[model samples]
Target chain A: MEALGVNLPFLLVQIVNLIIVYTVITKWIVGPIMGLLEKRRETISKGLEDARVAAEARANAEKEAAKIIADAQAEASKVVREATERAESAGKDVRAAAEAEAAKAREAAMAEAELERNRILGDLRGQVAALAIAAANKLVGEALDEKKQRALIDEFFSGVKSGKVVVVGESLSGDAAEVTSALPLTSEEQDVVKKNISAKEYAFKVDPSIMGGLVIKVGDKVLDASVAGKLEGLRSTLK
Target chain B: MKRVWARWVVLAAIILGLFLFTGFFGIGLGIKPIMPHVYLPGEKLSETPLFGIAGLYPTNTLVGLLLADIVVILIAIGVSRGVKSGKTVLTGISGAVEALLEMLHGITEGTAGKWTKQIFPWFATITLLVLAANWSGLIPGNETVGLIHHYDHGYDLKQVGPITTIWDEGTDDGEHHGEYAIVPFLRPVSTDLNFTFALAIVAVVMIQVFGFRSQGLGYLTKFWNTKTLFSKPIFGVIDFGVGILELVSEISKVLSFAFRLFGNMFAGAVLLFVIGSLVPVFAQSMFYLLEFFIGLIQAIVFGMLTMVFMSQATQGHGEHHEEAH
Candidate 1:
């Protein structure tokens, strides 16, 4: 053992040295290194967690942006639809007003034409009376009275004489009566016809198709006093 | 291309100069390499005691211990400073030491589990000390440049410029002219039996400390298993015998640990010496590399074995647990 150098003194020195070295290594080396390693690991995991949170936040922001954009688009389209509807309704109102104005204008033009036709018919009635008086003078070989001839012509065309409807038949009582004449009636003639009809309401009209006399309608009854009706009666008696 | 040629030229000249200085072809002082004398004990440098203690003085292995201590201290300082500065990664030597110890720590965690905190320091320290001591031997002038003393059968000394080396004086008419030998001032501490024995004793003592720590006084039952002795008469003798054998094996473990490191390191040193004396030049470099690998393996093996034994001590023996159930 001595030859191999295992003396107590050397062995003691080495053991003490080992203990000292162990302390140095444990305190100054191992402890700090392990702590550093653990800290590094923790830092890395925290950074990863932060990155993950950032990514999640970014994703949520993108989704919210998309939602807001979609809502804006929907609102914009709704505004466009409402504006289009208002424009169309305004166009329809303008068209309806234009149609009403055109209708009123057309009605006024027809009333004026009716009034001109009535005046022309009144002038033609005077010419027809003069021509008749001339023809009677040639036939009788003497001139007739002018006032009597005028009166007779007026009564024949107007279908009224002395403020009374000469076409009145029996006692006709109804809710309304319509009097037709070959020429437009004067207001006094319409009033005479209304009184003779013994109805609540009266409508006067001119129809040249009646030829000369009046055709009075009371309820469903008709008093055909036209010259065409007299001619049809005479023809039937001759046959 | 010209610079590359010049570099090769300088390198060849250096090799040729080495061959000439080492007396390759018996020219230029004709230095002959004498096979170094292998000593088991660390050779004392002086007759005087270093601390006035009888039979205790400064020796070559003690010098090697100091060099190894310096290396370990330097490593410790580098690591602590690097870690203290709050660097995420250590650089240079401290980085290398950290990487090596971290690997050892991983192994300790795998082996010892929860006791790794308590166990890894011993593993780290023992491996570092042994590794430093073993590698310090490989330095030039270690076990080579030393004191010359008179001996019965030894080599003559030669001086080549400022350096002194031993060379064999060839026989002249069947007579020897050399009567002196070189005693190196530094030998690796791993090659010393005292260091190896001390480490082994400490490791074994720690093993028992862990055993008692883990199991209290029940650890003694591993070597004195009497629980099964009275329970089963037929197997009682066998159990007692096995317990006694466990005690014997525990004693042998210390010897095994000590001699295993010392024998491998000592033989490696001897092999390098024999190879140097025989080939004298480039051949020793190859063995030096070989010894480098061997030294690292022996250091790790010593520490690893200690760790394994210590870890084993922390757990109850299987038969004891089985018998308890």
Candidate 2:
């Protein structure tokens, strides 16, 4: 130990010097450096946490934006569909109204045509009565009163009423004409009417609606000799 | 970027040119044979009056130790100054100091755990101080430039270096200029057993203190457990014997810690000296690098061993013994 220069006092002094160094190093160096490192670590960790939170917020905002866009699209489609349905129903109403108006006008025209035909028939009846009277005067060589004219026409129409209208295809000797008139017919007038219309049985009929017209009937067939009948045939042919 | 690379190439070329120039010229390399110095008291560089007291002066190794202390203190002050003022970022020398302390702290913390806070100062102190002392020896004039000494028969030479001085070449006339040795102004502090032994004493003492603090008076039972001896004689005898062995080992720790650092550092210094003398050129440079590594390793070993011993001292010896089994 002596040869190695292990001085006792110097060793103690070195130990003391080391203790002082230790004291100084611990107080000033290690303590502050460790604290700084810890602080930096905390700052870094906090920054990372803030970044995480910001990223989460961004994601949430994106989600909300997507939802709003989806809702707007859905609302737009619903509005479009509702508008289409309304337009369809409105078009249907318009078509139905136009069709109803056309039907109404057709019915009115038909009624007017019927009324004109009836009026024409009434005018023709008066003329036919005058003509029949003139014919009777010439054929029988008699002046007939209002009652006699009615009797003469009735006798002629009685023959037509008994199914005595002769058909063109059948034999005229077996068929007879039954005439209807507004007035009575005389026996001579009846003979004249019979000579004009062939029949197996002669019958005469009177109707006030016919005024002075003559109508002959044979089975289901009817022949109009009156002015009213001639006018009705003329109106049917015009239609 | 091209400019920066060109600058680097220019700088490297300059360095290579300087190296080649110096290598050829032998401008700095000392080609003399660097003999190993014994682990004895260094030759005196100067003598102080000390109020007329005898044998009061600074030896070469003592000057070296003081110089090492100054360097360490400067480094410590540099490291502490900015940190003391609460600065967050450090740079340059302070940064290096902080890095070294942090690394040492990490290693010590693993071995010492919570006790590291209490023990780290001593650990760091020994390491940095020893590291400085060890590296100080590698400087150009550490054991080279100093006072010249002449051996005399009338004077007690044993008080200085080894009685057998290699540089001594006695003349026929016995003139003082006949045989002499260069007593350098500085020698590495760790080359002296005193420094290593002192540090070891400090470490071992602290360990004992930690043991007492942790386990109370019961900590001494590991050295002499009479209670076990009375209960189980056969096993107790072995236990007591092991306890004595443990005590011996504890004492031996001081010697071990001292010799381990001293031997490694002292050997490295001698090797560098011898290699520098023999090969001198690039060969000594490689040894310098090796010495630097050895110095660093020796410092770490000293500090880590202290920390380990302190940690073990705080624990129960029985548990440690069981673990060993």
Candidate 3:
């Protein structure tokens, strides 16, 4: 009965107590705790699932937002590019139109200048003739007869070479015509001079005070047959 | 009805056979007896009280009850095992047994709410085993055995009739010397106060364990109970005094269980002895029948009280009041 001299009643009580404790812990404490743990686990799992779903939703929304921003940027860039292209094309058209207008204005100015130059040249030519006539009149002592002056101019021009005489004057001859017709001209010049100038009794009468004498003009030479010219010849003979 | 009759018939046959064997051969069969009066090992051997302040000591009855309790535990474990494994046959048998145990557990737990299930296994096992051990005394040779006499004064040996010596012996020299009348076989274990006290101590200790397990350290505070006292100082002193009384009452539970069981069984034994000795013919048989019923009833009452008191001790007073309501 005394295995280890342990109090038998005490041992019995301990055993009984152990049994009761085990039973109570198992049935009451452990069972409820397990149930609570299972419920907690389910709740945690559901929460995790919901969190995952929310996270996914947030990610999707973010992605959509990014896509929208990207699309907007692309659209904005597209609009910008289109606007730039239109601006460039408009600028090129405007530049080309300006260049064309400038070229037309230059052409018109050149033509107008050419016309003005020609009109001025004509007026100068008349002034030169008037001056030449006044100088000649001053040099001459008296007026020569028209027929005598014509004979003298013929006599002076008959002594020169046979070539066309070119007269530069303001008007066609009146008194100088006899002297101009007495001169012979080259064959080539004859045809051209006959078409361009008057051949019969041709004269270039600038002015009557260019001293009423026959002045024959040839290529580079001029012969003066006037009263002032005879007096200058006499004076030179005395000296 | 037929099964009940068959059980009765079998029990009668067993009794008849035992009676014949004991009456004719006097073979000294079954349990060996050591004394005319039952000797509880704890009371005889222990210098300290069996369930002293230190706690209870193990005795022969305690050992027997423990063995019986172990068997009950094993059976319960087996039943629980079957329940876990989904075995149909074991499940069916276990279910029936578990249902009975569970019903008892439910009643106790209903009183304590969720706490009863925790203590149910130990409580039920102790109750059933103690009940069985107490009733075992009614078996044929439990109280009847070959006799050996102690000296009327000292240590000399004598001889006597198998069961008659318990009443006849006294000190031979009249010097107030204590001597034991020895028997060759069986003793009714319950007749010993030591055995009953050991069982009570175990029940009491288990009640504490259950209380602690259910309510934690708060259970110990129930004994002191200063909360209400604090509110009402004069009432508190009285309540504190009552707390001391409660401690005393707890100690009395051991005495109650021990004295009640011992008194009943011893009284029944004495009655059987007187009746059988006075009229050795027909009255002996009649007394035997009465002893049989008395033994069963006493065992049942002891077990029932043990169950009830243990349940009460572990439970909170509030729960008891609620149940009463």
Using lDDT as the measure, the top candidate is 1
Better of 1 and 3 by DockQ: 1
Please write out the lDDT profile of model 1 over residues B1-325, one tens digit for every residue.
9999988986786676467546655655555567777889998889898788887778999999989988988898998899889898999988988888888988998999888889888898899999999999899888888899887777677776887766666666645477888889889999999899989999999999998998899888888978778898868777778879988988898899999999999999999989877766567778999999999899888888889888888977844556565
- State the DockQ, from 0 to 1, for candidate 3: 0.04
Give stretches of model 2 more than 4 Å off: A44-52, A55-59, A72-239, B1-39, B49-56, B84-89, B151-178, B319-325
Candidate 3 chain A lDDT trough over 10 residues, lowest sum? A174-183
lDDT of 3 by residue, A1-239 (tens): 35323355544564564456346434532343334435656888999999999999999999999999999999999999999999999999999998899888988997687556545644554454455445645678565564565434433333222243333333333322333322232234334334433435443323233333345554334555544455577789989
Error of 1 at B88 (Å): 1.6
The candidate that wins on DockQ is 1
Error of 3 at B282 (Å): 4.5
Error of 1 at B243 (Å): 1.5
Ten contiguous residues minimizing lDDT sum, candidate 2 chain B = B151-160
Local distance difference test, per candidate?
0.85, 0.71, 0.53
- For model 2, how does the per-residue alpha-carbon lDDT over B1-325 read when each residue is reduced to its tens digit? 9999988986776555455334456653222243534436555567762345455356776777787878877876776677666676778887877788788888887888888778877787778888888889888777766655654322112232533433323345744343445577788888877778888888898888999998898888878866568677787789889889988998999999989988898788878877765554457768888999999889888988888888888766765664563
Quality class of the docking in candidate 3, CAPRI style: incorrect
> How much is A46 displaced in model 1, in angstroms?
2.9
Give the alpha carbon lDDT tens digit for every residue of A1-239 in model 1: 98788898889888998888888878888888888778878999999999999999999999999999999999999999999999999999998999999999999998898888888987777677788788978998877787887777779887788877677656677887888888877777777777777888887777888788888888998888988787888899999
Q: Give model 2's clash tally.
A: 32
Q: Which TM-score does chain B of candidate 3 obtain?
A: 0.60
DockQ of each: 0.49, 0.29, 0.04
